[model samples]
Target: MLKKSELKDLVLEYGKKFLFPDFTNKLTWFVAGVGGAIILTPTPLKLIIYNWLVDSANLNSGTRFTLAELAPDAADYSVGVVLIIGALLHNIANRYLVYKEKKASSHDVSGQTNQIDKELFKKFLEDFPSNSDSIDMLRQQDFSNSFNIFRLANLEKFVEEWDTVEREFLNTDLERMRRELWEACYTFNYKLSMGAYDLNGGPIFSCIPDAYRGTDNWPAHVDEKIDELNGLSTTCFKLYEEFVRFGRKSIA
Candidate 1:
């Protein structure tokens, strides 16, 4: 009963709530806090060095000594202190960045997982045979009459062809035709899910393969046709599983 725009809005809202700005903000704060802590510790040491130079060494004036008179010991001590501070800063920054990245990655993964779960639930509802009554009601609506009549007519024709195949070639072509029918159904359902057509009328027939009209070698080629259709059906089902399950699990 949900409108296409409503469904889209829901998806966007969930994505924003469970997936975006907050995760990025937390990561930024973590990095800033670690960097600040590491950098602030070096300030006291710098002050201590300045005090020793001015009071203990009595070297208040700028022109009091040359570079050689400064002594390598003090220079070495200063260099060592700077290196230690830089090293700590680098470590903190690296760790913070890595942790943030991992957290963001996990959030993305969980988002994808939830999306797949939602999509599968939708497909289950669509594929359920009992839901056909609801679809029928939708088709009967005044809004549906404007654009969906053609698709409905085509679906009727397709069902008739399906019935004919079931009756005449039940033994030979039934399995193949069944597979094709399922594929057509799946394609139609996917197009609906993507909102590729108007709510009232969609390009369902355009998404389907042409009806089987071959008459030559009807008996001999029946098995081959069935094999081909089954192959296609299997592939489509596999695609569903991959996108709906395996791929999502990988991200999670």
Candidate 2:
């Protein structure tokens, strides 16, 4: 009964963890070898690079480009194209599995949180150990508490903990935007739970299954919080996408 957006976020973030962290490191040498030849001998190697680049017989048409189309000299053009593509692939790979601050990371920066949430959420749904007692617990409205805090704490110290990350390496603006929306949702959930006896993150207007919300006791201005909470969730996802896209472009 999970909403469409929840499913998309879970699947994408889950899939990201599987990406190889060393993808960029491995690809660098290939680009450097070809790129060095082009930079040092731009004109002479044009024909050779042009032949290798447009060798469609060996590779499929996955964003294929030619030296002529890329630059004045085919060699230089191919080098630019290769470097551009290699950079993008590396960016995705890095974000998907980059876990540098292992000792320093507290909560938000943990590389595997997204993947852990996915597994925990799925297991919660598919409970198997108990016969009746656990099944009854799953039916409770506050079942979300059985899982981890998928959202982050709003304190500045949480973000500061990640100071080990270079400013250039992390998208500070995009991460900040996401953090703002995440804090908005987290705060809203906290206030909502106080008025109605529910678990911390339970009864989120936008994310809760329609069946679950109908049973829970909501506040007078329920629509207002729903509107705000749903808006915050949407903004958070948009900011996350921006983080990934901007990282691809910014990685040198």
Candidate 3:
């Protein structure tokens, strides 16, 4: 004997697959068109008309159905088909109404689990240090040394921190934040690594002829780099702010 909960789950699962809204909507049309056509098919001539359609469509060329095979009489087959069609229509319409009503009432009936999830998500954001020390590990690097080496080390540390935090929160939104934060970190690191920057009162690397001397627009290029760095900084901080906002938002 199955439990009530298990039976309910099974039925819900079956409904989700077999009677999906779109599928049921299409099924309604299919049954209406095909069943109505068959019912209106003007009898004694009913099987002949159907078999003619089949033959015209080249459906199973060697075979045809008989009235006896379908039902004892033409009227009996029509009646039986009409009853089956009516029952199916009723079942589908009822299920569709139930589905819609449940959807409309979902937020009202969100219950304890939704509240618990909101709390858990908020708490997870509070505990996550992406906005704090983890991000700082990348930002506070000394570029005078092997900059890529520092970036790789800091990036690894940030990833380690992310890995630790990821185990705590299973939310898709949180996972998206992690991905965005990682992208921001990598973008900043790549920008800093590739470009020669004036740091510590000197150029970190000799400016390339292509970057400086090859074009008279080098000053504009330098301005573009500055703008890009500012944008990257803004993006990184925006993610941090988003995290803070999500944490602070009303759980109710």
Candidate 4:
């Protein structure tokens, strides 16, 4: 299990990693500044301009009166239209920029996450023998303690892999992945504990339930989980890609 400090650090780090790319975009400030100025200016200027155009074109009384009252009668309508268009464009552009940023950030985050996963995998592999020995010693002295260690080690491995998957994909389905892996680890451990052993006292293949002991079932289960992860990653990436494409198309 992770320490409180470690979990806190992970949350903070990932939160920042996800948020900073979005916070850096300056389009919002630019739009707000320009929009504020446009909306705050006097309405009389628009009335005067419309009045002049009305007279210059020799328009009828209806048109002339309409132009003269443009500020009072149409000011709200005109401003609403402008604001709507401006807001729509701004949101479209922001989405495109955010999508681009996430794509670039994922590459960097994935690299770091991969490195961490590999390191943890290596550490676990290295310590497996020692862990096995410790388990054996505890089993002789206290079975509960040995089970506790086994559980901890299993959970640690799961966490390491979970982190790796998150960093590698940066998908919104990270929570799902974490939950699935935790459940898988728990089930595996439970089954292992119930299994039988050989004369050498090592767990035997026959010890596991026949449902889990098929020649191909374990590999198939692993593949199925991996496929689920890949599908989630693809979905998030496609979401970003579609947002970028839609923004570009709207501009065109």
For 148-231, candidate 1 gives per-residue lDDT tens digits of 434344333333443443222212232343445545545544433342234324443121212322333334344453444344
User: lDDT, candidate 4, residue 119?
Assistant: 55
Worst 10 residues of 3 by lDDT: 142-151
Cα-based lDDT at residue 190, candidate 3: 69
lDDT string for model 4 (29-79, tens) is 454555565466556765676578778776555444334365453444455
The alpha-carbon deviation from the true structure for residue 216 of candidate 3, after best TM-score superposition, in angstroms, is 25
- lDDT pick, better of 2 and 4: 4
Please identify model 2 stretches exceeding 4 Å from their true place.
1-220
Colliding pairs, model 2: none
Provide the overall lDDT of each model, using Cα atoms, as 2-decimal numbers: 0.44, 0.45, 0.56, 0.46
* Residue 40 error, candidate 4, Å: 7.8
Pick the TM-score winner: 3
lDDT of 3 by residue, 91-199 (tens): 6677787788798787555655456657666555555445555356345533222222332444445445554543433445655665677678668656855665443
Candidate 4 or 3, higher TM-score = 3
Which of candidates 1 and 2 reaches a greater lDDT?
Answer: 2
Stretches > 4 Å off in candidate 4: 1-45, 51-76, 103-107, 130-134, 141-252
Superposed by TM-score, candidate 1 places the C-alpha of residue 93 at a distance from the truth, in angstroms, of 3.9
Candidate that scores best on lDDT: 3
Q: Candidate 3: which stretches are off by over 4 Å?
A: 1-89, 97-120, 128-159, 164-174, 185-233, 246-252
Q: Write the per-residue lDDT of candidate 2 for residues 89-113, one digit (tens) a residue.
A: 7666565545553445645554454
In model 3, the Cα lDDT at residue 70 comes to 39
